[model samples]
Target: MSTVNTTPHTPGPLLRMSDIRKEFPGVRALDRVSLDVAHGSVHALMGENGAGKSTLMKVLSGVHPAGSYTGSVEVDGEPRAFADVAAAERAGIAIIHQELALIPQLSISENVLLGHEETRYGVIDWGATHSRARELLLRIGLDENPALPVSALSIGAQQLVEIAKALAKNVRLLVLDEPTSALNETESERLLELLLDLRDQGVACVLISHKLGEVMRVSDEITILRDGRTVETLTVERDAEGRPSVEEDRVIRGMVGRDLDQRYPEGEGTIGPVRFEVRDWTVDHPTQVGRRVVDGADLDIRTGEVVGLAGLMGAGRTEFAMNLFGRSYGRYVRGSLSRDGEELRVGDVADAIAAGVAYVPEDRKSLGLVLDDDIRHNTTMAALGRISTRGVIDPGLETVEARWMSEHMRVRSHGVDQTVRTLSGGNQQKVVLGKWMFTRPELLILDEPTRGIDVGAKYEIYLIVRRLAAEGACVLLISSELPELLGMCDRVYAMCEGRITGEVAGADADQETLMRLMTRTGEKK
Candidate 1:
């Protein structure tokens, strides 16, 4: 175990991590990584998906414990060691992970003070709990009632509750990991504003995000990490009017080790006759009676064409996709799905797979892959029959198929036997894509495919999508980013309130034009 010298307090950065080294059984996750976060500033960490950002943060937050890694942590220029998460919290450090830690069934107040509840005579003090939670909520500009269950709030609101939970410990140095990956545009903007407010209050924030525009907007300094080491930390240059002047390409160079001349790859495929079509697709909400989740949505994808679905969070894009695939989401009310001009019946997931249709879900962690399983099992899961004989599996064939998929998908891993849960977010996503692609579908629907991955990984996925289209497959891409839609799709369809509002060629579409159609509730102008 390494030790830090007992240094006296002095004026310096609020937090400093020097020469952090973390290792797993087969990998050195971090190597000599260092970071310094000044007080009253937003320091952004930018990197590729497996670039050791999260590992370094875990060491600092005591999730890895003091003796588990070789590092020296300093607060107020005084060397200190954190034994565990609680010890780090007591030192005014709080971490809000990308996947929120709030309990959905509990009330906001209960979740905020979960471990350190207020007590009166050895009993939980309900009044003090709600009072303190309300104060913290107010500080973050959240106006919701603290007594409401966390499940009743939107994802954006739940994110605010997570911040409130951190504030309950009187956090001075806050760390947020990919905070806006799941949020809509409006929700993401509000959260960015809150971070700026926190900076104004002299709170030191370490923000880990892949959105370059968002980082440039709120970050005072940016640190770039690549392949388990620090590339460099550049101070964000500002113009005379107090606007960020740093080029996004510089950050990209640092992350990927070279300039990314183009973010989305160009496709050479030409569109043909309609290969997949859906008409009058109406689906009712499963839990709510007399309410339609997808209302008479109609669309068609031509062969070798990449189509985009643009909408807000609740526009039923995912529901429509899920229902079309296998009626997996909402209750199917009425719809007609056809392939090659022949009407098809997709009663369940198996039937959908047999009908040459595949869907990659939006929430990959819960609905896509089995985390505990190894890469080989997950890769061949959707198409096990191919590698089996007489209902008996062939281990050699399975290994061969899994290895091919991993190589084709560019999945970074130790081997096919590596557990899927231990891989990084980008690699796990590759496995999910590989599992679906192994089924060899004609019409592939990708929902939020690049939601939380880094730019380098995103570019790789985009190239894969183009390759699939070039191989004469029809693709329906659902994403919240309008730029992504414009960059990749041949045509775009806008959905509003469960209905298809408008359509435009991708070359002719812009953010404003799509936003107008996405918010439309009446006849299109």
Candidate 2:
């Protein structure tokens, strides 16, 4: 790895944003916020959803630009006025957002050196492009051919490609927003190791993540924000063995402005008789012929029960849920679904919804909600007929129902008329949940329901899930986090390679036991 510096530097701190205040139409997103990042160190930016963490980063990265906000940005003790993202890059700053910016159809080399490509006389130079791209890819530990399209790579590999593009710009200070939210455990560890390596190479990083364990591991300093204001910044204490010594509770206190005695709320719902059942479920890969994505899966969910599905990535947990919910994913080879002792003939999404089945997909942004639409429209999207008459929506009734749902879901926004994209991630997730809850389903399938939200928002979501179960709704909760399953579920089913390996009661389940089942093969339970 090589250290790249694009500007003349005499540094105490590598970057500083002093008293930044930004405002949208009716909201003051950021209020007099200040931050400083030391050279060759990792600084974590922690906060609950809508705490202005993203807004502050946008101000620093020139997304909001210079005149759009009131602030002074200093790089290496010299004031910098960044008119756009290009100007920020010239000053050796790059930001990788949660949603990666990469063209799917473009090759790895092309995406890496998209804008800053080498030219020969009056033409393009392919040889130099691939050579430089290969060098950057090696630095990030991504061993793949540079000519392959970015779509062929996993989410983790594509993330590394984004980093390679930043290195191509000679970035000295990098900002990563929820870098591992979409990754599996292995991929996340790899990315964290890469961050530590970059820090050792004299690059400063501003990390914004909701995962406290990862934030505590690699960060040198932690800054907490609350309600668009600077709370306090704490230096991470280290033990003699060089491990972090700061308690996670202390950081949580600063972010939510209170002590969270319990990270996961206790379930108060009582398990009842079986209300939903699946037998001999099998689904083949959509494009790959004769390959079963989900095979011979059987499960039962009782009324007022919160069941959990546990597995590693690509273990067919999601595939099984989607196949059961109106065959939304994969090609259904065989499956028998029954609800309330009656067989269901769910050929499509409408049929599933009509059969009282609701699915909240894992990728909420792409599959659940229309980002450009308002909360009112999204909340009423699943059951428009409830708020419509004579095949036309009533504007007054829509407002009444949407407002009620927003309040019921505890969505924080300017108004029901506010655009869904402008809200924070937690609030956006609330809208997705609200949309599905409007359908009044007997069985609700929540896939990775609390994937990217903060701890406080996660607790609220847990409460909502419990409330639904208490009201006699059967909930099938799928999560990658093991602790989540153990905390909120009455029973958990482990799947490995498209087969159910074991079933465990939540009271007796532990990480080790679940791991054994998740990795087991050859036997179906």
Candidate 3:
């Protein structure tokens, strides 16, 4: 990987936390960990799920507060104790979490200057707020109107706005957690470029991400955490010829605590006869009348087959899946679904579930899970009938079933009663999987299942998908990551402008081939 040349005048140890130790009820979340970020340099923190990476950042950002953890935090060479988020901000530290904290109803200007609004004699100065917000937006290469509602911007643009909000705070140390997890390939590249620009402008950045390629490309230093301790810190080592080199294998070994010879598990199962089929399925935009989002899309998934759906963001893959799953998403939806040559009646979510179909949505927090609920409740939510009699839930039976399902899905939690909101992204995803698995569906539709999760967690999820297919269940996988589709699916259907434009065998699929098909112009009729 080519490295960005950091300015020679970069300052030393812009942010440092030493001997940090944190604990929970029965868990040592962080154990004597430490990190250092130099001004104008990008430092990346990486580890498998449940590792202490996030915990360490939380301590630094004051989410754990001063008395909750034992640590010495120094900002710009001055020792300081941060009691809360406000204190951290006062120390010029800003953290942007994976789940953005922006309010959708507010305008960009309002969201950017949220808590620290420009005021004239104690009254809010709307004009000055918009002016300064625009300047920050321009600094980050985003040229959108500051008056636009934050919800109007695309996901990529919204991410840039978040950084702009941080810049508005005069942040000297910026911490970004999985910033590119939801972005497409092009968007990810642009965001990396922006980070490099920030580094050049003397802002120290701490990036926590599961995408090792991005980490290796953008970071000057990488720290790997495992379990609850520091595993190793890595930098590009130069040889006698003064050429820098980083061993990808060594980084993987550090994060996973062992070497992973293969990233994806091989699926040795055979594809059986067509098990699920959708014919001439069409859906219209929910609010836009007469505008069809999915236009007569026809597709099929065979027993033991893992089929991939590849397309751009608005290509209607999700719309099609939602429409097929009991007409849950769109208006004026028309579809015909059949299993094993027999037509199925799917009028709503209940009917869909009764028909043995399950959908794991792309947005887990908003759709697939109840964040406030415990694993016990979330696990059995989709198939509660199995644990309930005459509308009354059997708590003991539910707990037993939840425990078994959590164990089967390898959900890492204190217990079944642990709130899902507190679990890591990988574990939360496992809970979603368990919820659907409890239903014993013959066909499973997973939409962006591994998004925002670590590499080790992704591998585990892939293994589960393979296991489902091997056991004679049909799996429909939808993802924007081309490599994921190529690695996991048996065949892929390329969608464009609400239609299936092309089909390719997964064994022969490459990024270029898939992209060409996905972006091809004509709609299939």
Candidate 4:
């Protein structure tokens, strides 16, 4: 049996990646990148979307085989070559991707022991697997039965399952790519605690995240990547001694390549008369129809008004908006919606469009985009019927519209023909926004609008949101980030346990108050 050698005061670098290089067809994904992570320290990789953060983690985990890139990776003072993921796993390297790699139909125990299932004389050992999975769950502060189907679990619970899977691998080094991207405050904190526990157990972790605040909170060292190159590697402590003053600021500057005066921009303007309103609205959960996700809700947005929906992960904020939009996402939805003082029959997404409404869903990769198609195709998907003539599609019109949006939104791409899948998360989100924006709707519903976006891209989206509101278009912003909502929205509605617990004007809203309402459990007002 092998044991990991790790401690806060342990000597030498446990892993060093030197002059790493990887190139995709037309893009240089990684170029001469170098980063060093020490045992027992949480090293954070920070960068804007497509800044090659995930690529580096993949390389280390052998997702991109050792031969696929130009680099030298030394673990425990010895050079190594990992032919594939299995080899990497054998070498104590384990990575959990941003998008979870779990099969919904599989049981929790099955997911934990997927690749290396327990067996006795070529027979599946279900009893042993369940016990092992249960043990791993305990390490993650969970006590759920291993036999439960993964589909029965919520996204947050599923994340814990992934963590357990990593533990099953006897990992000495762990890599988490945007682990908290979809997590709410409580879930995020819990996940962080588990990582700390693992670190205490002598495991090293590499955290890749765009959330700078959380990154700053947990990271022992920081590495910034830019345009596939390693800009700098920042060591938080020097030989177990804290760095000098201004070290944090120095790290932030390196990550962004400039000093960002603000984390979120503050803007104010006139919020004009009731453009959209929802009264006595309710939406039930998808699986549990009898249980209401949103009990009864009331919301209003005036022309040029930016209304923010603030809540925890299960606060029912998204459910309320989704059910009212076009009835496209929820089940057993009963809602009354009005637009411009007239009743709106939002039966489905198309009906919502007819009422001058547009929705940008939260999941861009799955629901918001056509992965195999080019950007031009995805940009015009929502309004294809409008762009088409008598059921015969007009490629010329689509191309023209796509080109205009690509330039207008400042989407970075080789051309409109570039595959949407190849673009960065932020750029893909822009495509989602562009598709809905091009329709020229009177009211826009943005769900987590700036999520997973870098500081520079977030600034651009903020400007876009402000511009839209300034143009007398109603904006409904739904986000988990309290700072963003408070900074941009004209008014904020705080939801808790599927109801609007409180509503506050933007001028008076703050993290403390919003969070108070967001986490409140009981009959929501």
- Name the best candidate (by TM-score): 2
Candidate 4 lDDT score at position 489: 85
lDDT of each: 0.91, 0.92, 0.88, 0.84
Candidate 4 worst ten-residue window by lDDT: 1-10
- Alpha-carbon shift of residue 359 in model 4 (angstroms): 0.7
Q: Given candidate 3, what's the lDDT at residue 134?
A: 86
List candidate 3 segments past 4 Å from native. Answer: 1-11, 237-244
- What tens-digit string does per-residue lDDT give for candidate 3 at 1-525? 122333343256887788889999888898888888887789999998889878888888888899998979887777888899888988778899998989999999999989878899999999999998988888888889999999999889999999989887778788999999889888899999999898888888999998878887888889889888888788855577744477777788888878888887899788989999989898998898999899888888999999999999889899988888888999846768999989999889999999999999999999999999999999998988999999999999999999999999999989999999988999999999999999999999999999988888998999999999999999999998888999999999999989998888888889999999899867683
**Per-candidate TM vs. native?**
0.96, 0.98, 0.95, 0.91
Candidate 4 residue runs with Cα over 4 Å from true position: 1-11, 237-249, 286-290, 331-334, 519-525
Q: Sort the predicted structures by TM-score, highest score first.
A: 2, 1, 3, 4
TM-score of 1: 0.96
**Clash pairs (backbone) in predicted model 3:** none
**lDDT over C-alpha atoms for residue 255 of model 1:** 97
Task: Indicate which candidate wins on lDDT.
Answer: 2
TM-score, prediction 4: 0.91
Of candidates 4 and 2, the better by TM-score: 2
With candidate 1 superimposed using the best TM-score fit, by how many Å does residue 246's alpha carbon deviate from the native?
A: 1.4
lDDT of 1 by residue, 100-119 (tens): 99899999999989987899
